[model samples]
Each structure stands twice: as C-alpha cells, then as structure tokens.
Target: MPAPSFMGIYPPDSVQEVHQSLPLDPLGPGAADLLAGDVEYRLHYLLQEAKKFMVHGKRTTLMPEDIEHAMEALNIEPVIVPPRPLPQAPFLAVPIPSGTSGAQQQLYTVVDDEIDFATYLKEPLPPALANSAGVKWKAHWLAVEGVQPAIPENPAPSSRAGPSRLPAPTTGAASLRPSAKQHLTTELQLYFSRLTAALIPTLAQLPNLPGNSAPGAPQYSFPDAERHRLAALASVRSDAAVAGVLAYLVRWVAESINKTLMGATGTIGCLIDVVEAILDNDVLFVEPYLHQFLGPLLSILLTVPLGPHPTPSGMSPSPFELRTRAADVLAKLVNLYANGYPGLVPRLLSTLKKALTASPFPSPLGAEHPPAGRYEGAVLGIGACGVHAVREAVWGTNGDGLGAINDLIGLLYPGEGRKNKAPLVRATMKALLLLTVPKPEGVTAPAPDAAAVAEAFGPHFVRAFEKRPWQAQELMRLRNGGGAAEAEVDAAGEEDDEMEEVQA
Candidate 1:
C-alpha cells in the first residue's frame, strides 16, 4: 500500500529525532514522515477533546486531569503528566532557529539560585494579629405579622424601599418585639425570623372600617394552618440550641395575649398556636423562661369578653374555641414540667378554683374570681388536669366540687343562683364526667344505679348526665372501677358529637 498522504506530509526531521532512542535502521521510503504524521494526529486529537471538557466545565484554562480524561474517552492508554507550573518570572519569547523574521513562541522561565533551609528559618514571623472575635449573630423581626417596628436591625421607617401597604399596630403594641439586648449567629437569626413570621398574626386592625361599619376587620392575611404546621415541625427539629431566643418568643406570646384580650380581634388563635408549638417542641429550653408563658396563658384561659365574638357572617373565631385550646396547652405545660416545678400545678388549681366559683356579690375576694363568662374556661382548665385531679381534687362526699358541678347545672333549675348558659352547663358536665375516666388505681366495684348518682352529685348533675348517656355510663364506671359498661361502647359510640368533639 502507498504511504498515506497526510502522514507523508509530516516533518521527517522531527520523526528522525524521535527515532534516535529506538533500536531501528534509517526510515525506508516515506516511513519517517508517516510515523511523524501519526504522532501529530494523536496529539491534535487529544488536545481538541481536552478543550471540549474545559469549555464544558466553564473554565478558560485546561487542567492535566482534563487531558487524562480525554485520553480515556478517545480509547487511548492513560498518561500521567504533572501539571506545568506557573513561571517564577515572566517568559522570554525566542525565534524558531535562534534568529528569524517571524516569531515561533518558545517559553523560558526565570529561576533563582537555591537557598538553604537554615537561612529561611532566620527570618521573622508575621506580627501576630490581635485575636479576632469568633462569629456572632442576633435576630429580630424586620416585619412581624406584617407590622414592621422601628428597631436597630430594620432600616428607619422613612427609609423603607417603597410605601408599605401594611397598617400600624392599632394599640401601638409591639407583639413580636425583640429584646433590648440580643446575641445571635446568622443561622439563629434566620430561624427566628422564619418561625415568628410563620406562627404570629398581625396584632392590630383598624378600630372600624372606613365607609363600612364592620368592626375589627383585619388588615392583613396570616399564614394558613398548613404553614404553621411546617413551622412547628422545624422548631421541634431545629431548636435544640435556641435558648438564647426563648426570651423573645416568650415576650411575644405575652404581648400577643395582652393585646388580644384588650379587644384586638382575630389574633388569639394564632397566639395559641405559637404557645402550643413552643411548649411541645422537645428541644426548646422552656423551663427557664416558662414563667413568662404562664401569665399569658392564664390570661387567655380566665379572661372574660374576649373579642371579636363570632361575627354574624361567621368570619371571626369564637372566644370559646380559643379558651379551650389555651386550657389544653396549659395542661400539657403543667403535666410536662410538674415534676421539676412542684408548685406549678397547685398555682393553676388555685386560679382555676377561683374562676370556677366566682361570686355575684361585690366582695373584694369575689372581684378576684373571673366573671361568669369565664366560668366555662375555668371548668375546662380543671378538667384538663386529668381524671385523677377530678376524682381527688374535685370529687368528695361532703358536697365538694360535686356541689359546684350541681349548682353549675343551672339550665333546668328554678333557683335564683341558676345559670341558663348551655356552654357552661356542658363544660361542667364534661368536668364531672372526668370522674369515670378509668384509672390504673380504680376500685373494683359495681356500676352505680341512677339513684346512687343523683344522691352523690345532685339532681341537677344526674339530670345533665342522663341527657349524655355516655357521660352517665362513665359515672357508672367511676362507681365501678373499670366498669364493664365502657367495654359495651362500640366505634359508633366513640364518634363524639360536635360539643363533645370540642370538649375532648
């Protein structure tokens, strides 16, 4: 076969120089040129492949690994070549044959004479920098429930990027205000901002809408229920190191409660959510700042006339729902921290006892008890303490809390002390039913008859319980330790009514 033309065109002199190391005779015919052409083609192909990788990597320079990778892709044996180091001094360009009209680029690096290691050690070390402080951070809201406060972290109110659409807080209260002093890292700041924004609602609304007499209409939308769920999950998982920010959270809760109780509409539900999530999170250091939570929670539980009462259009939350939820959260808090803080449950019991039996007369002590509207909240608070509290703390033979429950069953009573409130009577009955919530220490006895229940609690309670057959059966269970009557309750019976659902 004739020598390939492309191979034949390659420089023979170059091939001859390469051939010096080989054990071979002088090239026969165009063999040297053919060998040179093959070498040239391989080198060109390798570089072109490597250049593609460099471009793909979005880099201007090709690396040695790129060449190796190119060889692998092109089905060639790998070559391990060290990277070409940068020149110590600028390169000096030289001509093709020592002197030429046109330039052929040849790189020459400047090199310095070698120095002994001893000479380098004699030089002075750099002046030590005064130790820099480690990284630190703090977080306060730039916008909380859409209301931005004038704080150090936020820009001046006038300096905002554009005119803010959000209204000022109605009561001029800063519900999510950060503490006067704070220390945080970038991560904590981010977490605080996200969690608060997720959990809190706007604290203010215009007193009344313009050209619309709709009282307490909210100015901004809050995050939906699903968003609060995700935020709670994040808090539970990520707040192990959140002790520093606990104060801010507690303060926010307190401010929210006070503001909501003072006729700020539509934020109590959001505030209760925040409280529940904070207490439920295992990682939170709640005890140190727990006292801060109690005041706000108790205020929510025992306050009367919480607004804005359910609207005619059914747009706003009922105060009753908020109180019940707060009571549940308070119970959880007490149950969880009771072992460590012995006085916690007792204080709650004392406050609840007062609210449960408030006097209509104008006595100084009577004034301390919550008004009649809060009677239901108080009953819920007591019942949330569990069946044990109901049996021992509330139940007694000598007209103990049983009388309170009887008198509270005033809907059908003819006496002047009777209360005609359906919600209160239901709450009272639910509390009374707690007596039968089968306990580990329950006494083994027969289920009580109607005569026994009426004699023990009172006619009013028996009347109320008779209406709630399950409750009356539960009373039988309390009379008979772990009553067999409870076993008769099927899944159909387990599905509670709407009132029972709320109470449960």
Candidate 2:
C-alpha cells in the first residue's frame, strides 16, 4: 500500500485519520491547502476532458471513469476516486448530518421516483407543468421515447461564419437509448416528475393566505406541481452532466416572467441571474439541453405566485440565498453593459422600472420580513444599477444619463406616499447625488438647469442636491454659461485656421 505522503507538521495520529478517511486525500499537510483545492483541481481536469469529449459526442457526462482516465494520463493516481452508489432509486433520501452534537439530520427525500415513461408519452403532462417546466419533459421524454427531429438535407448554421454543423432535431419515443444521453433524459424526467408531484400542495395553499388582500396577490397563482418541477430542474442544472441546460432554464424563467406572467420583474431578475451565472463564468459551459429545459420552465415562472407584498413575517424564507442570486444576476447584466452590450441598456432599465413599480417600497410594516427584504433589495439594486452605471455605459455623459437617474428619483419620491417612500427616496436621492458629481467624459457638459434637476427629483430633490456643494456650483456654472467647455475647442480651432491662412 502506498503510505499517503503527509506533508505537514501534524501529529502522526491526524495524518492516519485523514488517510483513513480519504486515501486519495490529495490535500494532506502540504499536498494542497484544503479539500476544496483538491476538488477544484479535479474539476478543472474533468472540465478539460469533458470539453474534448463534447467535441466528439456533442455532450457527455464526466463520470468517475472519465476522471480516472484523466488522472492516469496525468500520472497522478492520488486523485482517482472509487465510485460510490449513484443516486438512482426513487423515494430515497440523502441525509446530511447536522453540526450540533445531537441535531437531527437534514433529509432530501425523493417521494416518487418511479414513473411509467410509456404512459407519460401517451398522455400529455399536466398543462401547468407542461407550460412551465414543460420543455424539459417534452425534449427528454422524446429522447427517452427514441424520437428524432427531421434532419434537413442542406442544413446551415444560424450565422454564416458560425459552426456549420447542425444538431439532430430530437423527436419521438424511439430516441431513448442505453447510452449516456438517454440516461440523462430518463433521470431528468424522473426527477421532474417527483418534484412536480411534491410541489402541488405548497403552491395551492399560498394564495388563500389572509393577508393577500391586495389585488395583485390573488392574481398571483401557480400550480403547486410547477414548483417541484423547477426544483427538479435546478437539480439537473447543478449536475455536471448537463451544465449547459442551466442557462436555458434561466432564460426560460426570465421570458416566462415577462411574457406569461406579465412583468413579474422581481422573479424575472432572479432567473436572469441564473442565466448570467452560466454565460458570464469562464469555468463552465452552457449545454444544448438548456434550450429544451428552459422553454417550458419559462412557462412556469410566468405562472408561479409572486406579488408586491412582502411574505408574511416569520415565514422563514431564505433571504440570503435570494439576495445572492439577485446580486449575481444583476452583476452579470451590469457586466454585459460595461463590456459593451449597449443595445441591452434600454431593456435593462425597462426591466428595472417594472420591478420597482410593482412593489411597495420601504415596505408597509413587515418590510424586514424575509420575503420583503429580498424583494426590496433586489429592486433597489436594479434601480441603483440603472441610475448609477447602466446609463453611463449607454449614453456616456451626465446629460444623457440624467434621464435614467431622474426616472429612479421619480419612483423614489411619489406624491402623498412621500412618507412611505421616505427610505427608498433618500437612498435613491443619495445615489443620484453621487451620480451628479460631474466626471465629464468626452462630451461637453449641458448647461445645468437647477429647475429641471429639482423638478426631476421632486420637492425633496433639492435637499439631496444641497448636500453636494461643489456639484451644485458646477451645475450653476453650466447653467450660467451658455457654451459648455465644448466651445473652447472650437475657438482654438478657429485661431489655428487663421494662422494657417495668414502663413499661406
């Protein structure tokens, strides 16, 4: 037996324990910094090999066998992992031990694993699930049923210079096989089926909540089946086998919120972030399966119950996770704007506008509640992005960007409700105050109109401006002077022209 090389100042006992736990524990003493580091290295290697396999097979799962092969090629047996039983059985659970000494373990139980694949093919999936997480089942079910899309004799790439090869259109029951693709399809279908079955009751009970007296709340309804479907879809996305599918699912969610749901901006932003994670990250690939996965998921986000009110207090919603997701999505969109997707600017701002207007700001009373906080922060961040950066990226000047900033200010300082909007108003105003500091890029400053600026911000707007003395002075100067600094260059050009004429 190869004695595990322990590169540390650890006691011999600790080394023995680590070795006992993981023989291929590559992160011994000086081996690597931690277990995470080893996992990262392994992931990098697996991704590299998976990319290669993708070239040959379009898409393939990087199983333990693939990792083992890569390890052998690298001459590093220390990284090879022995296979454990895969999560195959339905109605099973994965119990994670709790940190507390005697705390109850967390269980991820699968309620219904078995499904008659043939029977599902014969009957249409529930319309709600079909519309929302529908695309997934259709595509995967077709694959399992061994269907193939008709291949054109003269297929062409969508772009002239893009990859010329076309993906085989997936169709009927005949497409299912014993191969990896078929296996992925079956697993996904089973997962979605189980999840949809579990979600029905939770969604059904939400609408009838007593506090949902707001008109929008009752209108916001989703089939309980759809939530489980999304959960299952998320699980599939997390899987290394079909990473590409995640982006598509996210896009679907976004599209559904905007289209089917009619401007459920809060939920849509969350979906956008999911897509961004797939697109912006250098470490991962968004696979083709996503197109199939997302088309239906979009339908679901549209139907999922979402409204302006904060969720009831002590509902125990996951605020941190929700915030992180929203931030991730917003960051990606902002990055795209920064990196030169100028065309996306108008849409980004519009999306932010819809989200902000849909919810009550500073929240009514239970604003600190998990659901409310998540919505408020998400909305505020989008508004901030719109006012602070997206405008600068698109128009590239104070004059051009000011309209966008003004829009945010208007939302923050609505009449009569000025008291309710106080916190949001102050936050937005402060952000705008910072933005007003002229960083005059290439464009000549527009003569500042105090009245216009004040009007844009409403009555409290002047107060926000009062705090920034220098910016106010600059604005005054721009207002007093007819020609911005832009005129000076023309004066100099005229002088040069005269000199050249005299010399000639």
Candidate 3:
C-alpha cells in the first residue's frame, strides 16, 4: 500500500524522474509509487539510526558525520559523482594579409582555463566537512625565567607579575591579599545554578517537620529529594575538574548556616545530603582535599544556635537535629578518608567533647545553663564513628575518653555537676546502647564489657529504664549474659526502628 498523496513525503513525479534516470527499462505501471514508499521507509530508518549517533556523541543537534556514521553502521555507501570538464572558449582566427610572407603569418588562440564553469556548477561539500579548519600544532614557552609571558595561552597580563611578587604596601596592599571565601568560577556558577534549580522543587516538597507534621502538610514515605541530590552530585563527581566546585559549595553552605537566621537547619541537612552523594561516588578522588572539609564539618557539629534563636513553628529542624546530621556527615568523612588524614578522629572527638561540656555562662551565679542540643550532637557524633570508635573512646590509651563517657553518663542523673536534661539523657542512652551492642564479625576489637557498663551506670540505667523499657531489657540481657536470644534480638531491632522513626 502507498501513503496518501496528501502526505507529500515522496512525490510521484520525482520518483518517476529518478526511475527514468536509471539505466533500465521503463518501470511498469504503479512501480514509481512502490519505489517512493520504499524510499520513504529507508529514509525514516536512516534518520532514526542517525539520531542514535547524535545521542551517543552527547550532542543535541544532528550532524552530517552522524548520518555518515549511521550509513556506515548499516553497510550503505552513498553514490559519489565526478565533476564534468569545463567548456572550451570560442576562438576567432585573424586572416593573414595577401601581401605578407607565409613564414611571417601567425595565429593567436583565446582559452578560458582560469574560470571553470563545471567546478562552480558542481555540488558543494557538506558544512560539517567544509567548514572545519585544519589543526596546526605549535609549542611555546608558557613562562620565561620564572615569569609568565603575556601570551594568549597565559592567564595573567605582562604588566602584572605573578602572585609571588609582593605589592607595595602604600599601593593598596589590602587588595592584593587572597580572599577569605572561595568564589565559584563562571562555569561552576552556571553548573551550581542549574543543579540548585533542579533540586529546588524536591527540596520544597520535603515536610518542614521531619517526624511530625500538621494535618494539612504533604506526606511522603521516602525522601523525595534524594534522587535529585544524587543526580546533581553525580554530575560533579563524573568530572574531576568540578571537584573544586563541590568543595566551594560545601564552604558556601557552611557560610550560609552561619549567616542565615531561619531555614538554615533544613538547608544544612540538604547540604549534608550533597556531601553524602559525593562521598558515595567511589570513582571520585576526594581524598586530596578531605582535610579542608573538616573545619566546615566541625563548625556545623559544634556551632551554637545552629538554627534561628526563635525558631518559627514547623519551619526549621531543631538545633539537635541539625547538629546530629552534621555529625553523621563528619563520621562518614572520617570512615572514608581517616587514614588519608591523620588525627582527624581525635580532633573531632575533642571538639565535640568541648562543645558538649561547655557551660553557657562563665560563673555559677549566671541564670543561663548549657543547652541540651549540644550534648545530643556530641553523643550522636560518637555513635556515628561506629562501634570500634566507641570502644576505643571508652578504653583507649588516653583516659580522657573513658572520662568523657563517664561525664556523659553522669549527665543522665541529677548531681552537683550539670543537671540532667531530657534531650541529653535520651541521646546519652542511645549512644550507650550503640556502644554496648555486639559488633559483627571481621571487626578485631575486644568485646565490650556489658556487665562493667551496667555496674558503672546502674542507677542511671534504672532511671532511663523507667522511661525507656527497651534500654532496660537490653541492660538486663547484657548483665545476665553477653548474648541475646533471637526473640530479644528481634525486639532490639524493632526498638532501633522506632528510634530511627523518632529521630527522623
């Protein structure tokens, strides 16, 4: 069957002309329509194949090379016609005079070799082949005698010496100083703009209240922003040069936390998600600058007033929650690149302990007391370092580790020291539970002394048990025997799930 004439895809007259040009007998009746239909089908198929080439090249516009590649893939060769020879110019011969000698007679012929009409009439090459300029390889010294020349290839101007030369103090030395904050390059700015635009809708969709929401707030079973975050970070990870952009973005996020009053907490959470996405990409080489991130991560973990002083209703996450998320990001960084950066673990632990134990006021007469959010952040930070980190902190060569644990436990009970705050108490209980839990195989640490922990913090455990039965059951199991039965394990798993829900 033939396509309708209204389609006008392959005109019957053109098909007939093409058939007539071939060196064959005239086609039978209706043969031109069949040939046109076949030609249309093959053209569509070729175009589809050409589009595949364009997509494979990561290009949006189709090119003649794409079409050629498609033809090659299909084992098809296009016909090439040679150009015709140019026409000869007309000649006019002058007759020799009757009186002139035959030997003296001469004739002149006019030729048109300079201008070839056939060359002008021949088909032109495709733009893809004709418009391309030839590449000429050349080399030159980028720098001469430790000074870069002001060439097209060099970035700096000849009038200005490289950064090593000190500017005169009288001539505005302040302007010569390096900027304290990192600035995104033009390319990076564009990338960041696109990524943030892509993420805005997803971020907006996340409920302001993590675990609790008003009756009308939108609800979701999973994190809706996760996919967007992964895609944005994956783009950065795929390009090595963009790694610096990721670092700059991290610093920018940290600065935002310090500068913004409201909504900084939620923004920080999103930034942590970005960090996780980058870290999760195993192909990215993040170890070189991993140390630089420690400062920002520590600041997030220990920064007081992490959220607004007077947080708006259901608009921001709690200070504890923000710090907890920061701590989680820090732990992941440590676990992934700790060996690359020595003393990271100890420095983080020290910073967290100071924040946890710091008093709000200088003297006892002052009415202000330490905020419970800091303690919770500190406890969660410890737990994020994994069970081995917990054991080392509790039984390492440095006695301060154990002392820190004791201090944390002491905060759970009323005493002459800092009074027990509920948030701190709950956080401490969870941290202790994580520390005492049996680690899986392949970890070479000595088993944690559950009985010793029970004896040391028995009264505090009892107090916490009154409020949290799950902790009490675990403590009893640990004291009676270090092993937990299947049922008890299942119950503990359920309790962990509940805790995660509450934390979320």
Off by over 4 Å in 1: 1-182, 185-187, 203-238, 309-316, 361-371, 398-400, 409-421, 438-463, 474-504
- The collision pairs in model 1 are 137-184, 137-185, 138-184
Q: How would the candidate models be sorted by lDDT, starting from the highest? A: 1, 3, 2
Q: Which is the leading candidate under lDDT? A: 1
Per-model TM-score versus the true fold: 0.48, 0.31, 0.45
Query: For candidate 2, lDDT tens digit of each residue in 312-349?
Result: 44332233333334444454445544435454445545
lDDT per residue as tens, model 1, 88-168 = 565556534656667566766555568886776565432221121333234568797899888888888656633222222
Candidate 3 local lDDT, residue 23: 61
Local lDDT at 234 for model 2: 61
lDDT of 3 by residue, 100-126 (tens): 555556466674457675665465664
Q: Candidate 2: deviation at residue 408, Å?
A: 8.7
Alpha-carbon error at 262 in model 2, in Å? Answer: 7.7
Output the better candidate (1/2) by lDDT. Answer: 1
